[model samples]
Target: MTEKYRERVCNGYDHVLTIDERLYDVRTDHQHLLIFKNRAFGRVLALDGVIQTTEADEFIYHEMMVHVPVLAHGSVRRVLILGGGDGATLREVLRHRTIQQAILVEIDPSVIDLCRQYLPNHSMGAFDDPRATIVLDDGLHFLQTTHERFDLILTDSTDPDGPAEMLFSRPYYAACKASLAPGGVLVTQNGVAFLQLDEVRSSARHFNALFRDWHFFTAAVPTYAGGIMAFGWASDNPELRQQEATTLQRRFSQTGMTTRYYTPEIHRNAFALPQYILDAIGKTSP
Candidate 1:
């Protein structure tokens, strides 16, 4: 029998991946979840008709999300991750030897189980790491209630729509701000700036109000179906992203980390935004 697949339209891109096999399909309380295998992207996970991550290039997305900030910060102990149910972000966070604790707040537990079973490579048993604690609840509510502080908070969430809409809200950004320790940094997956201009602009406005310094960077993820994926960088310290090239290179070398898409040079240049994007975000400079 021949299996059929459907097209998912997101950010004005029509994405259609061949489904060699469907591993799971269910409607969770939050949204529809689907896991399937394909030749191009290998094991694929999609939520609410939008592709989340793929086995082929998942490293590119996860590495950039984790290493850039960790390297920029130089050292971190406590970390919080929101909306990354697949555990990929957690996996990368635990790579830092300085990390003492990692708290992951995922609204949907099913996403974790399915990803564990089907997308094993994405997480690579990161859930069972001694440093990780998985919280199955609303991220906003957790942030509002938790008294604990973190050195880094990474919102590896979906696009600014559906269940993830509040993750990008001003109040949520404020909560994230309050949840962080002094000198802490917060990063977010801001989607493709070329297509989702409103998301980038709105996020920039809120971040600018809350943080002393806020900037953005880009990474080219083939599966994301856009020119480049933008990551949001915000912190009270203006010097965090402006680390000298020599310092960053030295720190990166000490970590003994290897990445497919992220390098010291890329880290240095990621913040170099194009004029159109700066204009869209109402910024005159990088």
Candidate 2:
């Protein structure tokens, strides 16, 4: 039999992975969902022809996204996560003993259900935690209407296209900013900087206008098909992004959490951007 393969083409880059087994393939009301097993990545999930997450390196992305802001704030009691239906982000947030509530707003219920069933390790029973509140609504609507405020907000949505196009807009970012408590921080999955420079540039512009401090951080996820992935960071408190490594280490130690890819050193260094990337995002420095 011929080998099966899947190719993800984005921003002039093509990433092809061999499919060792076909698990689930369906078109939900909102988007197409595909899950397959690969020799290198274990279980792979793709939404709307874009690679969302894989078992091998999910820790890298999820840990950096969740821990950086949470640990930096050092007193985050409430967290709001938008569009992380896969639950990895929630899992990371719930690891912090300081977190009292974690509300996840996802537009499509199918993504949550199917991901829980098919990508069980991605969530690892996070959906069943008592501290977790799952809301089946559009993120922007939830942000606009919710009275609750969070110490940290994470936008784990897909790329800026199709169902998620509005998420990367200025209004959506403004809504997220409004939903934050004082000293709160907002982090977004801003796509890979090498190919998706415009996405970072747009978010940077919005953050510049909205927050007292704004910057981008870098992480390398093998399946994301770009040189380095950038996470958008914005906050009214500039000091949150300037925490000393010792302070972050103290906060991390108190949580008693073990991470694979995230450390105080890594968190501190992620903010150091290359000149080309800084130029692309229209910033000279962090």
Candidate 3:
């Protein structure tokens, strides 16, 4: 690698292809998106340097996220996605014909611009869809202000810091609940399951306390900071769909998306926590 091949701000990834030395915006071969596949994280959107999704396995993260709570609440039509600049989650969300609208709230225009230029394939034609509304602002603030009710709210923000920290706060959670229409479902990326156990458990505890029905679920995504990722859901009675597998199978594939991940068993197991995770939740007791 020559000096020209390297960048001034190199955020490494596990896999990245150098399209052009001086291209400034070098796009990847498989995804057709420009990224600096950094040595550590494998691929980040080239301009802003936010990891768009990883080479190892982005589907696991995307599929489980868009499906779980969705399948849990089958009547979903309007959806709100907070902080998914990558567009993968939006892509996954759009797969459901049941979804009439998808409002994506991302803080950085640069991230979306970088992703639109780089991670196109990861999200199909998500950005191009007329049904998707992209808003550049703080998600927490949007939730607090928007009285528009949604059937499902998916918060796929960055790690539990920076501009996204408030999304995990109690006030934001309350706002999310208020934004839900009747039996609305709320789900969020609860940080790395293994490394941020406290954050995950605390989030779950808070949700469990606030929502009459809420539970923590986990999925495996190889590219994330941790191999395991956790998400939480809340409703009135904590009643997840009885037949998540069947519903997803008929609805999603009907829309012509044969998903790589998200199965009924996986849906069940994602919520099935180990005793330690349970004890971990208990340890944080007040």
Candidate 4:
């Protein structure tokens, strides 16, 4: 039998992965979803012909996304996650004992249901945690209508295209800003800076206009297909991004949590952007 493969083309680059076994493939109401097993990445989930997450390196993305803000803010009791239906982000957030509530807003219920069935390890029972509240609604709508403010908000949306296009817009960002509590922080998935510099640039422009402090941080997730992935950081408290390594270490230690990729040193250094990325985002410093 011939080997089966799947390819994703983005920003004029093509990334191909061999499919060891096909688990599920269907068109949900929102988008086309596929799940398969790969020799190296374990289980891989793709939506609309783009790889969303893989078991192998998801820790890198999820940890950086959840921990960096949580540990930096140092007193995040309530968290709102937008579009992380896969539940890994929720799992990471629930690890913090300080977190009292974690509300996840997802547009597509099928993504959450199917991910729970097919990508069980990705969530690792996060959906069942008492602290987790799953809301099946569009993120923008939830942000606009909800009066509850969160200490931290993480937008784990897919790339700025298709069903997720509106998530990267200025209006969506403004809604997220409005939903945050005082001293809160907002982080967004800005895609890979090498190929998706425009996404970073757009978010940077919006963040700059909306907040007293704004920057982008980089992390390398192998399955994301580009060189370095950038996460948009925005907050009125500039000092949250400027926490000393020792302070971060202290906060992390108090949580009694173990992380694979996110450390105090890594957290501090992730903010240091390369020259090209800095130029693209129109910032001299991260």
* CA shift of 282, model 4, Å: 1.5
Q: TM-score for every candidate vs. truth?
A: 0.96, 0.97, 0.81, 0.97
Q: What is the C-alpha RMSD of each candidate to the true structure, in Å?
A: 1.5, 1.2, 5.8, 1.2
The 0-to-1 C-alpha lDDT of every candidate, in the order given, reads: 0.89, 0.91, 0.71, 0.91
For residues 90-164, could you state the per-residue lDDT of candidate 2 as single tens digits? Answer: 999999887899999998898899889989999999999999999998888899999999999999999988778
Clashing pairs in 2: none
Candidate 3 has an lDDT of: 0.71
Off by over 4 Å in 1: 1-12
CA error at residue 178 for candidate 3, angstroms: 0.5
Query: How much lDDT does candidate 4 score?
Result: 0.91
Local error of candidate 3 at residue 151 (angstroms): 0.5
Using TM-score as the measure, name the better of candidate 2 and candidate 3: 2
TM-score of 1: 0.96
Worst 10 residues of 1 by lDDT: 4-13
lDDT of 1 by residue, 135-254 (tens): 998889999999999999999998877889899999999999999988899999998778777788998999989999998999999988767889999999889989999998998888
lDDT, candidate 4, 11-38, per-residue tens = 4678888888999999999999999999
